[model samples]
Target: MPLPSIDWTAQQKAARQRSIAGGGKPGLTRMEQLAGKSGREVLEGMMSGELPYPPMNETMNMWLLGVDIGRAIFQGIPLPQHYNPLGTVHGGWFATLLDSALGCAVQSTLPAGRSYTTAELHVNIVRPASHRTGPLRAIGTVIHGGRQLATAEARVEDEKGQLYAHATATCFVFDVPMA
Candidate 1:
């Protein structure tokens, strides 16, 4: 049987709260600050269609579901240790964010019952993000969706909108059996 699902937002929130409560050191981590933002929740809600998207004139910090390239966006926060010794955001962070955004971009295209898994991923880390770079945004989209594979492209930008990384992922779809 399929296992019980974990609520992503709730789980992340509780974990952060616990870490803060434990308190070996003080101050909210960068990821924590970004994840706790109301804009972040808005993005999640928009993806689930719980919230209606804004007008074209509306400028939102959060990612909106099914947005065109102009306004499309998705954000992610990694653990405190997600950075390199130089205190720069690691490539792995970009990998995960690109994976999620690319997969979710495909997910937005899927019909009910049919899901997808990443078949292959390729990323190029052009630069790195310092603490000053703040959180990160991985914007992704389906370049092409074929019968067997869906192609996606993603760009990872720091808070300043600097292009830190870019990637392409191919997702294989699971074609559900018809009743």
Candidate 2:
């Protein structure tokens, strides 16, 4: 089956507009400001510019587009700088996109005072992409959310929904340390 056409450029522009409208900027959120907020609340804060977005997103040319209780969506633009010697987008780029989505999906499932770190990640690239690939999206969804651990999976797909890569991640859930 064929996926529906998507205007990726327009989608990207719209998302950026919303981010700016909400005063979203790349930086760090102070621990104090995160106190007692559920994972979903923290993510929502970032989306709404009440908290800082991660600097890594800027570095990777990716942005978190949306989030829900156990899901996260991110978009990335592949540029020449992200290519490997073979003249294709590097696997690391795919891994980073998948990792970000997977981590965020798990994070979105946590309760207040809880956090997670990626304990394991595995990526499988099924196709190649280049700067010309336009915008690609990594959609992550939590498979299991537990007190001590969580698992999630993600897929990197083009605007037309062609799968480029897929990955799974396991995260260790823990309590945020007291200040």
Candidate 3:
């Protein structure tokens, strides 16, 4: 069989468009735009390309696929580069996906000028993921959102709904200065 191919052309085009001359704004500048909007609005903006996608997501071949108040979903593919010494998808990939989803779920509950950082994360790898796993999704939902803290959980599953990993996280919420 022919080796599978991954496409980077579209992502490259988007990267170029995110350059300063291409109308890309810096993170702080963009956050200013989110100052008064809801977290859901900010996340939607990111998905729609109105805001810059997080560099980490791009680097890891993950993207924000969907979001709503107190919920978020991300999609990623396990690639050859993600393999560990044991020849399976690295645990870090699972952790990253789970953390991202959980944090974003909390983020989706924030008001403008507010942000959050993962204070704690607990992950359980239920199964191994390989490149053949095809597309995987990490779905997150917020369990609690207090003034200074938020808790959320997430699961990484394949298209057929087989769970690969699950995680829970607590995030510290804070306000950032408006642009």
Which one wins on TM-score?
2
Better of 1 and 2 by lDDT: 2
Candidate 1: what lDDT? 0.57
How many clashing residue pairs appear in each of the predictions shown?
A: 0, 0, 0
Worst 10 residues of 3 by lDDT: 1-10
Judged by TM-score relative to the true structure, which candidate is superior, 1 or 3? Answer: 3
TM-score of 1: 0.58
After superposition, which runs of candidate 2 have C-alpha atoms over 4 Å from their true positions?
A: 1-6
Report the number of backbone clashes for model 1: 0
- Two-way TM-score contest, 2 vs 3, winner: 2
What digit string (tens of lDDT, one per residue) describes model 1 on residues 1-179? 11124443343344334433544122222332223224334334344434443231122122322334212345555544667777776777678767767877776666544557899999998986654555566778789877688899989875456888899898898765544
How good is model 3 by TM-score? 0.82
Query: TM-score for all predictions?
Result: 0.58, 0.92, 0.82
**Residue 56's lDDT in candidate 3:** 71
lDDT of 2 by residue, 1-179 (tens): 12235576666666666766888888888889899899989888887777888887777788777888899988899889899999999999999999999999998988889999999999999999998999999999999999899999999998677999999999999999988
Q: What is the lDDT of residue 72 in candidate 3?
A: 88
